[model samples]
Target chain A: MSKKIVIVGGGPAGTIVANLLTKKLKKEEASVTVIDKTGRHVYEPGLLYVTLSDQDPKGIVKDEKDILNKKVRLIVDEATKIDTKRKMVEMKSGNRFDYDYLIIATGARLCPEEVPGLKEAAYHFYTVDEALKLKDALEKFDKGKIVIGVGGVPYKCPPAPAEIACFLDYKLRKRKTRDKVEIHYLSPLPRIFPIESVDPIVNKIFEKEGIKYTTFFNVESVDPKRKEVHSLEGETIGYDLLILIPPHRGSKVIEDSGLGDRGGWVPTDRYTLKVKGYDDVYAIGDATDLPISKSGAAAHYEAKVVANNIASEIKGIESRDKYNGKVVCLCDAGNKAIYMIILQSPLVPDGSIVC
Target chain B: MSEEPKVDRLIDARNTFCPGPLMELIRAIKEAKVGEVIGVLSSDTGSKRDIPLWTSKAGHKLIGIYEKAGYAEIVVQKIK
Candidate 1:
């Protein structure tokens, strides 16, 4: 009998594995199935562009069925629990699928409500609705003190906060209101950017662009009525406009099934990408608690390793292919110029990024 | 099944992490003549499973997989 490979989540990580499996294994060798809550697949990186009205939102989304391989079964349903003992996934619609191998790529969820008054005051661009709303807000605003920063760490796309700050500066300049608006980039970390090497470059750009920034400004709460942001460090900053990247957590299924850590991130083997305490289950993308940026590049590289190894297992071959922690990320510095950072291994210093 | 296939080249990839072993095997396979048998010793548990798949994918013949003291010896013959 053919092995059953079930993937949860229809993001880049899930879809890449499913498509690659279809190519590696014949129809009779193994069946690939993907279960996603939403049938729609959004190009999340495009959300940045959507926020600035750089691209049409319609161009970045597609039906899951349209993108997935025809042989791979697509189930548009919410996975509620994963019965590891039985190797079955239970869905919200009372449906279940048994799998010989399981891959979790549920990605991260934005929790704006985690911070008091954050959901009411901040403007974020993580989702379609949020991006569109921010776009509208930016279009209407002429001048204000725009306080832009992250609400918490471990959010998807680590560079997004910095990127958005630069984009905001560029936008205001385009409106010829650069002198009127104050752009302050804030962060919870001791440095503006997580990567030490990249932080210096960002500082140079922000300085040249006349953008103010502060580090270690961990958010305590926001007072929408007072138009102020309170940091745990006892610092209060008032903003006429606020753009904060909301805190992120793993999928609810991971939390509900008790399959993840406090932050809902799965404890996965760094090299093997296998979830700890489970031999047959693996995690990729934002689902895993790997200390890497939860970017598309990270997910795509991790997916290749998972797909290659899983396909080998099904083909009666024990492949020793492991994830090398390769991530190729391109950052938009605005002004129609961008730079790429390719990290072969984040855990080790390879001197991979060049300014 | 007990008799070990004769290999023209041997690549000891012990203590190497995945893709490392598989990558060495591929490079060795390329350098060897078409009919030469190549064996790769890998301590990476994943490589034991990955090499065989890669050999087959590359249209090479997997002779056999032998278990060693702390590593796996995977033998593959270049077919084309």
Candidate 2:
């Protein structure tokens, strides 16, 4: 019988693996199936630009059919549960697919509603839909205090909130409303960039841009009716427009499958990308609780390692490939771009290199 | 007349980060001649898909893709 490979999630990780597998294995030898809840595949990192209306939202979105190779089967359905014992995945559409090997790439999801009144009062730019909504809200508000708050740590795209603040600063200036709009950035961490090396540069940019930075201010709740976001430090930030980066967690299926860690991320071998318990089950991208930041680039790197190992396992070859936990991120600092590389191999403090 | 030079260039973007390797690949493909193949070796996971998608959209052909030693090699044949 032909080998059946089922991949859950059609985000960056799942799509890349599916495409690679289709290129490597002949259709007759192995069948690749990709399951995703939505047909829309958004270039999530581009959300930073989209939220600020710097890039057209349409450019960031592409149909799933457009990206998937011909050899792979794309299934549009939410994976409800993964039955490792049965080697099958149950979907919301009442379809169960059996797999000889499973790659879980179900990416992260944001829960702004978890914070009281946040969904109603604040704008989110995490998803394409949210980006569009935020763009409309920002354009309508001519002049007022704009607060960009990070709800929690380990969120997707660590530098995104900073980028948003800078882009908004540029946008307001372009509209000649810079003097009218006051922009404030609130983060849970003490520095703008988690890595110390990159913090000073980011701090300099914030100062030049005149964006107020507030650290160690954990947001407690949001009162939509009053247009106020209450922080744990007894400070309530009032805003005419609130752009929020909410807390992110792994896919519901992974949590429901009881395979995720306490933070709801899949537990995987740091190097192999294989699930801790089952050798046949592997995870990549934002789904895994890797030490790296949850970003598209990170997911893509994880996918390469996962694909190589899976192919090696199927061919009965010794897999020597291991993830080095390296990440490269691009931060748009208004007029220029700042590229940061984090090398986590030596286990340095925060693994940061700013350029 | 002799045949045109089939451009064959390999971009070793291993250990590089987002937009850095991706932007480089884009620039390399643009500078290459038509009917040439640009092989991109990227350890950054996003480049594997990003390169292929960009090639396809730009009217190029994704000839092959494979992963080795934690790096993904994607070859794009410039049909345009």
- Looking at candidate 1 chain A, the ten consecutive residues that score lowest on lDDT are A345-354
TM-score of 1: 0.80
In candidate 2, position A19 carries an lDDT of: 89
List residue ranges in candidate 2 displaced over 4 A.
A336-354, B1-80
Reference-based TM-score of each model: 0.80, 0.77
lDDT of 1 by residue, A1-355 (tens): 8899999999999999899989999988999999999999999989989988578999999999999999999999999999999999999999999999999999999999888989999999999999999999988888889999877656778788888888888888888999999999886655676555567888888998999987657677999999999875557899999999887889999999999866788889877899999889999998987766677788998888888888887777866687766776677866657655443434332323434
Query: What does candidate 2's lDDT look like per residue over A1-355, in tens digits?
Result: 6789999999999999888888767776789999989888998878877767568888988988799998889999999999999999999999999999999999887877667887778888888888889888888888889999776545788778887888788888888899988999986554565544467777887898899977645576888888888864456888778888886777889889898865578877777888988888999988986555677777777778777777776777885588766666677756545434343321122332445
Q: How well does candidate 1 score on lDDT at residue A304?
A: 86
Task: Rate residue A145 of model 1 by lDDT.
Answer: 92
